[model samples]
Target chain A: MDTISDTLGRFGGVYLLPLALGAVAFILMGAPSSWVTLTIAGLAMGMMVFLMASGLSLVFGLMDVLNFGHSAFISFGAFVAASILAGLSGWLEGGWFLASAALALALLGSIAFGLAAGLFFETVIIRPVYRDHLRQILITMGALIVSEQLILAIWGGTPFTVARPTFLEGAWIIGDVSIEIYRVFAFVLGLSVFVGLMLLLNRTRIGLLIRAGVENREMVESLGFKINRLFIGVFMLGSALAALGGAMWAGYETLITPALGGEMMIVVFIVVIIGGLGSIEGTLLGAIIVGLTANYVGFLAPKLALASNMILMMAILMWRPSGLKPAVK
Target chain B: MNVLLSIRDMKTSIGQYHVLHGVTFDVREGGVFVLLGRNGAGKTTTLRSIMGLWQPSPASITFKGQNIAGMTTADIARLGIAYVPENMGIFGGLTVQENLILATTKGRFDQIRLRRIYELFPALEQFWSKQAWALSGGQKQMLAVARAIIEPRDLILVDEPTKGLAPSIVAAMGEAFREIALTTTILLVEQNFNFARSLGRDMAVIDDGHVVHRGTMADFAADSDLQGKLLGLSA
Candidate 1:
């Protein structure tokens, strides 16, 4: 097992996983244009999931908090962004600058809500259940259910259609392949966020504290920094990211419902688990693999597509129990 | 000499398991104060209690004339008390430089202190950018100790610093501790009697979560019969 894993590492390491998956899919599909389209879809989908999963992974890794309510941020973000876009529907029909302003406003709304809601959730819902896994799970799950019900009360049970601005409504066609502009946009947004996070984690003092806290919370506290305060900051940041992901996802899907949070929760968890809890890089890797697998399987074997993520998770866990890239302590 | 840290009837419990019943000792303000005992004799628990890692109420643990029991670990630490856990508590994912950077109050290093640390543990300076997990055991221990003293600390609680170290490395650690003691008081919880005795100014023996003997290291070393009675064959 070690030899196989070591060999895998030697061959460009785990980061090559998405590309490898894409290669296999390309070979299996045997249609260059279709493969190109699916691969782009996969990368875009992976980025959105990365946004959602990264924060949850950090919360799980550092604070040891099993936040089931995390998906609530995703759900609320979607609803909030969707509502704002619908309110500003006139802007979508206008020029690129106006459309972009509307989109930016909606995103800002989601991010703001995420930050505020996250603070409330961390202090009220999570702080009380620290270090107790059972309670953490139960309380967070309870929060998720309540948020879903709250969404129903506010947005109603009907599926709401999201209005994309004219700039993001069409696709870029080159030769036989067609790439949706929205997917490209999602991919860019996710990449930008990922890069920003990397810079923060690697270049900043707070980032150093966060990385160290993820590895050893006790040691971090022993070094004289209040970890609970850091916990609140991270929880807020994670919540905000999840919200941003949800907002983007709403735009991608074009339609969303109250079940949006519950639906995305499973994939978010799979990403966190397979990527290794508490590692941002691991979360991104896991998300890409999941995205590629889902898109490929959905086209190749539509019936088996839903179970693909679960199967992949089991396979990965059986091979490496702690995960592909666990934060080493 | 002033009592830098005074622990009176400090008891700690892990879940339903009561680890420390009533451990009491005082660390004077200077040099190494060794707390030695056999394995599972609650020495580590006593140190952990002082750091407020385990909060057992109704116990008085005073540090620098302030009672710190039941306070958060970070609060105790912010009061200039650093702790080096038995596991070293090195952030394996972080670089050696990053690990040291986390220990500083303002995330800025004093050049003189940093130079002194590099002099004491040259390996840390050599692997400044290397991730801590890749470091050897001795180097990791050096990083742990180095982290504890990265900034000026009033008192440092160290647990078993010489465990699993090579003989030469242990001697080097002894030398480092001796030099550190000139500036900061250290309450060391160790099982290695020879290493503990070499640098310890005052010493205490704990058995079943209670102090059995307390005096100067010289007096404890002179009585082999007392050492046998307290520490058994290991002494």
Candidate 2:
């Protein structure tokens, strides 16, 4: 019985479900070009969401800390990257080499600020609430509010436009399917990160310790490893990932606002919940589902785009109470 | 025999409930010291306190003459002590090999020690890449023991190696424990009187967070009436 369920779960959850969802949308639309465009857009969006959700899952899985204020790092990254890019707009319009260099500098700046913010958040805001889920939620929510206000104070309460680097401004027109270069970039970046994380987690000694620590913290400690320090490092890494996602997202949307992070929080939470709290693979799957659902539904029924993800989350939860791939259980 | 670890009047509290009260015992070097107690007799808590999982107040837990009462669990483990909790504390998500790999300080198993562990718990090697969650209960227990002895530690605290197992597995576990006792000192908490009596060199009967009896296991085994009075056993 256990083997049967395990086999079915692996088959259904990993492959059939995603393919079936995409096929349904393709059949409904009946336009191959439109389906291809939407699929690419959805995959790109999914990748970006995966970037943000992966960190939350890791921190929650390993440390059991529910950081509602994680979006603060996202907002900081967006704003920081936006400012750097805006300041270097002249260099961004120069040759391909200069344009790429400017973009790299902006991304690095965003990651640096994100790291600093994550260090401070984990040390000052999160350290006190370890193992206390209720306190973690309450305090992190409060921290989120304060962080949003701080962003408002620093960047002013107005929306700002973000321009893609000149090299990434156009689309690849293949017959009838138009693929935005930026979306492809986002997809490649997200895929690289996902692969990198997988290798880091599966191939390294620290990764083995992290997985073990997640399963049994005391056992890891009893083996003479400082799990607390490992958790702190994980938290920081998660924050950095969120920032990377935020920077990419700002360019994808071509806009930044004080509320950028706060707004993305809803989508991020939905992805994390749907993906299972700590499972990275689940997060990726969930993000893609959400991305596809949003684009497909938005095209079919403009009014339902906002509620589609919520409905999807509810349906997935009903089918799998612990989310699609619960890391703990 | 030289005393390797000594716990004197150790007191511990879990939340508002004080669990361990003035518990005292000594573990002689290179011998099996069985802590015999009934359920909730603070046997597990005593082992946890020794591993520094629970902070004991107004107490002295000395290991090799150093006071290590309130140290962190990792710090105590660094002093060459390993713990196998009652639940086996196996990482169910990880493979058997991965679990053992994580237990080593260098994150890689020593080939010599690995071979020795495999010789003792051959089932672990058979399921090297299998997730620990899939292992049977007895196999999991064996893996837990294998992890503790992966490195040559000075001392090991094992909680209930045969808590729930078939008679055959329990006998096998007893033999394994006996073999392990040849190399390192062990502080074991056990509810199985027969199994404990078979392998234990020294024994202590604890009740309600206090040590009621302390002597050689042979002496305890010889006195059936004392065993009945303390452990409610005729054996």
Candidate 3:
């Protein structure tokens, strides 16, 4: 009995708590179908949120600059992918080969767009406003408005459909349940990206410099590294990641509209705040928890979907002011 | 001694608050030059200005006979100068080994250099795998110094090394700085008069951003009146 108590005391409140809650949710809502199907959906949505939140959290962690314009980058990527994929039918007829080719183009195009936007924001807007928080907020908010308007002008007000490739069509059956291939594809893409990003940060000199910058930007600058160049690099990388998620979501959801970004802005912030500021792992865990909770609640009581996320965040904040895993002192 | 870095009438302002008022000092090549002052007297500011952390007014600085007044910190650092800020400024998340790796940009990991640094401070080798935050205050200070010296630099600027450290660590830091001064020109800002005097070199007393006194450590030690006037505390 003592050993049982000790084990619970040791790891119960850690990630185990969240895992248990998520499992219970799976068993309840997605029961008749294999819990694994619901789990996969939960995991994919969780990673999608993670992909979006990690970059946002990193920028906030390093620069202390709250970027409200981040959602715009995500929406922009989705719109870009949808428009390119939608337009490809005019130039090429067959679906699979053309879809594959168009996806490749969309990936490259969105990254380029994101990189340019990041570089431009760093130089023209963010650099000057580093000294003033109020000015930064106002300027970035203005930029956000401009981006949203640009999205509307380019893609129009109509919701555009993002067609799934023929290869990703139908569902994979495991036991009594069936899982859509598109969600699984999104899960693979998101997790693969998360893994790739982890490698980039851990196994590179640039990553070391970035970690240093997170601790002390002044020290990094004084250590013979071009601060401007590093800042630009980080911003562009962050923007590109956000854009990739956007593009993937567009394909996964089969629709892209400008308002999608504005709607997601609040949820992204909630994930970042609960994930412990600047921690990559915290972001991942927080994103998954939030995703599964929202998904399950939306399944159970459709009216309580949004409120459930808000309540979960509020509970975490009330309990842990510094977040689940605060910055190491 | 030859002059390696010269600060001539350097003036700087941190967000409209003028901290350095035309401070001028020369760091002689291969010498331990200490800037002595009380808190808020702008000694740290002088070191920062020289490192190009703060852009002092143009036409007031030169390094190795070249104008460096408007250069960025990174550009100045590339010219073989390193700075250790007021706070140790060690990245808390990184291990000691990773910190050392990040400091090495020359592409030669230089095992000999690492061994030499370890020889100077053996405490580092034991804590190589530990995150910097987990180390004691003294270890962090040693790690900061080790980081600056592991890579080659013509001159190194250290601000308040002995601050918030044990007396034993301060003594060890003094000896380490002494050994490093043999290879690199050092311009250090120190408030600990005993530690500064123990270093045994030229000393500049900065009061309100002006160099009011510049002489040997012995000369300053002999004159209590000047020390009191400049430092505002009896030694």
Better of 2 and 3 by lDDT: 2
Candidate 2's error at B87, in angstroms? 0.9
lDDT of 3: 0.81
Summarize candidate 3's per-residue lDDT along B10-39 as a digit string, tens digits: 899999899988888777898688999888
**TM-scores of the first chain across all predictions?**
0.98, 0.96, 0.90
Q: Compose the digit string of candidate 1's lDDT tens values, residues A18-85.
A: 88898899899999999999989999999999999999999999999999999999999999999999
Clashing pairs for model 1 are none
Order of quality (TM-score): 1, 2, 3
Per-candidate interface DockQ score: 0.86, 0.82, 0.64
Candidate 2 Cα misplacement greater than 4 A, ranges: A1-13
Alpha-carbon lDDT, every model? 0.92, 0.89, 0.81
- Candidate 3 lDDT over A1-329, as tens digits, reads 56764786687553664688676876676576745666677778878778777888778777777788888888997887676767775433466677678677877787778788888878888899875789888988999999999988887888888765577778888788889887888788778877877787778788777777777888888878886787788888878878877887777778667888778778888888988877676787788888778777777788998799899889989977766654435
Alpha-carbon runs more than 4 Å astray in model 3: A1-14, A24-35, A90-98, A325-328
